[model samples]
Target: MASLRRVFATSILASVLSQVLTATAQPAFGVCYGMLGDNLPTPAAAIQLYKNHNIGTMQLYDPNPEALQALGNSGISVILGTKNEDLPNLASSVEAAKSWIDAHVLPYQGVNIKYIAVGDEVIPGESAQCVLPAMQNLQSAISGSSFSSVAMTTAVSGTVLGASYPPSSGAFTGDAKRALSGILQFLSNTHAPLLINVYPYFAYAADPSNIRLDYALFTAPGPVVRDGDLSYWNLLDAMVDAYYAAMERENFPNVGVVISESGWPSAGNGNFTTPQLALTYNRNFMKKIVAGTGTPKRPDSHLDGNIFAMFNEDLKSAGEEQNFGLFYPDGTPVYPIFS
Candidate 1:
């Protein structure tokens, strides 16, 4: 009897410890740490800002050595990127992919490298042809290394959706279908999520007359649109579900979707581009995700996303491109994110 009781006690203790670890290790909402600005803070200071704001995840456009070094032992999850220009080299040779990983990823000791995004919005052309091969090679390299826990994915734009209205009608068009199929197959095999950049701001600005500002801002008074049985109260949810539907149509309905980037520009040419609007949109977005309410199409799943930028990148093209940052280059908050 004492032996059975001991076993039971051990089992209960193990269960409790598992639950505690799961809760503590849950991924926090992330921000994109873009380094396009001339006056952005050093990576160490940037990590401090992230710590201040309770941001536990960060996405970088490239694996800069300094940034990777700063992230070490920081307890922050990182999603690193390989620039489009390097895809050809990585894809052409598995040795190159392994070498790149060794140089960029392996050295970052204790930094929780979650995902390696191969390229940003690469469509099926000469560059796009290299994406899948590079991803495959990278995945193999990571699997063989100490960082096998890291996953591989590519970020694509919402323009890949052929028909987005009504959400259920979503499907990939043209070269997107071919490119995405290979990606989806890879994701399915590895159980990695699809990273997509969903910009309701761009969608709204493109057709302001048709897209309601309140809906785009996630302050919809009521259901803005009903597609079949699913009712969408906000544009972000709809935009995400459109990708879900597209994936479903591709017969990979179970693959997860991660919004790699989404944010409203604080200043630009658009009538809706203002600090107040940006603040409203970002706050509302943060609240919705924190609430853990998934889209109507995937109500049981928590959607993981990263806000577009950490600072307004002055080096970007004129207008909205330079105004997505939540902070100034000097690490000053452009607006309060948490209140």
Candidate 2:
């Protein structure tokens, strides 16, 4: 009897420990490492900063050679992007895609490349025509390589949605719908998630009259928007669900959605972009991702996403674009995000 009691106690303790470890492990949340700043740290130091904060993933805006080299054997997952200018060539021939992978990706065998974003916010424009072909060619190229497991996709802005007021009524704009039809189908067939840059800050900044700040910041006291049986407490989930609904409408319901970029600016806007609000939104966003919370539309889905940026970019367009970093150029935490 004594031996059985001891075994039971040990089992209980192990279970509790497992739960604690699971709760603390936040592999789903990541930060986008933007290199528009001339004063940013070296690739090695930037990688170290991510490690110091326990950020397990990174979203690189391009296949930066130095960043890739630094990421080797670092155990950090990466979402590598391709330059928009290269899209025409990548779409024109499969050989160009293979060459790109050979030049940029194959050299870094130790880097854990998760997704290869073909372009950033290029859809519904001239580059939109090149996106699908580039993705297809890249997919073919990747399939023949060791990094075949890497998902190939592109990131798009929330402006693609023509109707998103009610989550259920979400549908893509005519141009965006036309462009995404093939892309969405490809995503469904390949099991790759669509990378979306969902910025609630932009939405709120655009229309503060109807959109409450608490709803956008995930601090709503209760359900702010009731879409039938689904209640939205925050704008992030609503925006994400809108994309899901739009995809469902487009007949690609199985294709997943990954938020490639989302963050609040710390300055450059009056009364809207402040450090405290940025900290609150990011902290709450990280909590949601860490908890593996899903939206009401997809209750069982795990929300995998990257925060907008790692450090403020001085060279980006003036104003809020330059102020989205969680850290300053010197690698100090702008706010206690990891804390």
Candidate 3:
């Protein structure tokens, strides 16, 4: 009797330990590592920067070999991307997809690669045709390989949706609908989340007269918008819920949504792009993610978000594009983001 009791207690302790380890393994938030700049730090130094800030995941704009080498054995999750131009080639030939994966993915044996994003915002017009085929081929390639556990999907722009204001009224229209529907089907089949780049800054910058700065920064004085029974305190939550509503409208309510890119520019041509505003937005955004409170529409679900950039890209032509990074090229943070 005593031996059986001891065995039962050991089983309970093992179960509890497993739960704790699983929770610890999951990252609360991550940052985007855009290597579009001329003076960004080397991969090794950049990895240390992420470690210093406690960023447990990284979304790279491409499967950079140097970056992969630095990330190996670091335990940071990676979401590597394939350039849009490569999509057509990859879509046309499964062998090409396998070759690309073998060259880029198989070589990084020790890196914690979590997902492979096919292309960025390619679900529109001519490029839309390549999205699913590339994803399918890539999925097949991964399934046959040792890296089958890595999720596959593409990143889309929030501009793909129509009538996103009321959240509940959101829908994909015209070409976007056809393109997104097929992509949604692929995601459903593979059990991969739909990654969307949601930037409230763009909306607010386009129409400052109607959009409150505090609301856009997630520091609203009160709930600024109401959709059906849901009250949204900030623009981020509304934007996220808008995607959820759009997915539900397409009969894909179970498909998960992950924010592939989101960040406030520290400097731009307008008053809304001040460093203080950027700091406030990113800090609050991180807090919201860490708190594990999902958007009003998907309150029970945890939303994974990646901040737009690690370093400001000096080479970007657009003023705002060069200003999105949380850090400067020399490894100095543009502002205090983490506690």
Best by TM-score: 2
Model 3 pairs in collision: none
Candidate 2, residues 79-158, lDDT tens digits: the string is 99999999999999889999999999999999999999999998789889899999999889888679989988899998
Clashing pairs in 1: none
Q: Which candidate is the best by lDDT?
A: 2
Q: All candidates: CA RMSD in angstroms?
A: 10.9, 8.3, 10.5
lDDT of 3 by residue, 1-339 (tens): 345334433544335433433455455778999888889899889999987766888998887899998888888889999988898999998898999899899998899888899989877768888988898898888785779999889898976888798998888877888888888988888789989898889989999999998899987878999887899999999998888889999999989988889899988767879866787777667667666779988899988888988999988878888999988999976765542
Q: Residue 67: error of model 2 in Å?
A: 0.4
Query: What is the C-alpha lDDT profile of model 1 across 1-339, one tens digit per residue?
Result: 345334433544335433433454443568999998788899889888887777768998998888888888888888899998999998988889999988898887778899999998887566888899999999877775789989999998976888999888888997899888988999999999999898899989999999999999987889999998889999999989989999999999889988889899988866779866787787667656555779999999898788989899999999999999988888876665542
**What TM-score do all the candidates reach, one by one?**
0.91, 0.92, 0.91
C-alpha positional error of residue 41 in candidate 2 after TM-score superposition, expressed in Å: 0.6
Clashes of each: 0, 0, 0
Cα lDDT of candidate 2 equals 0.88
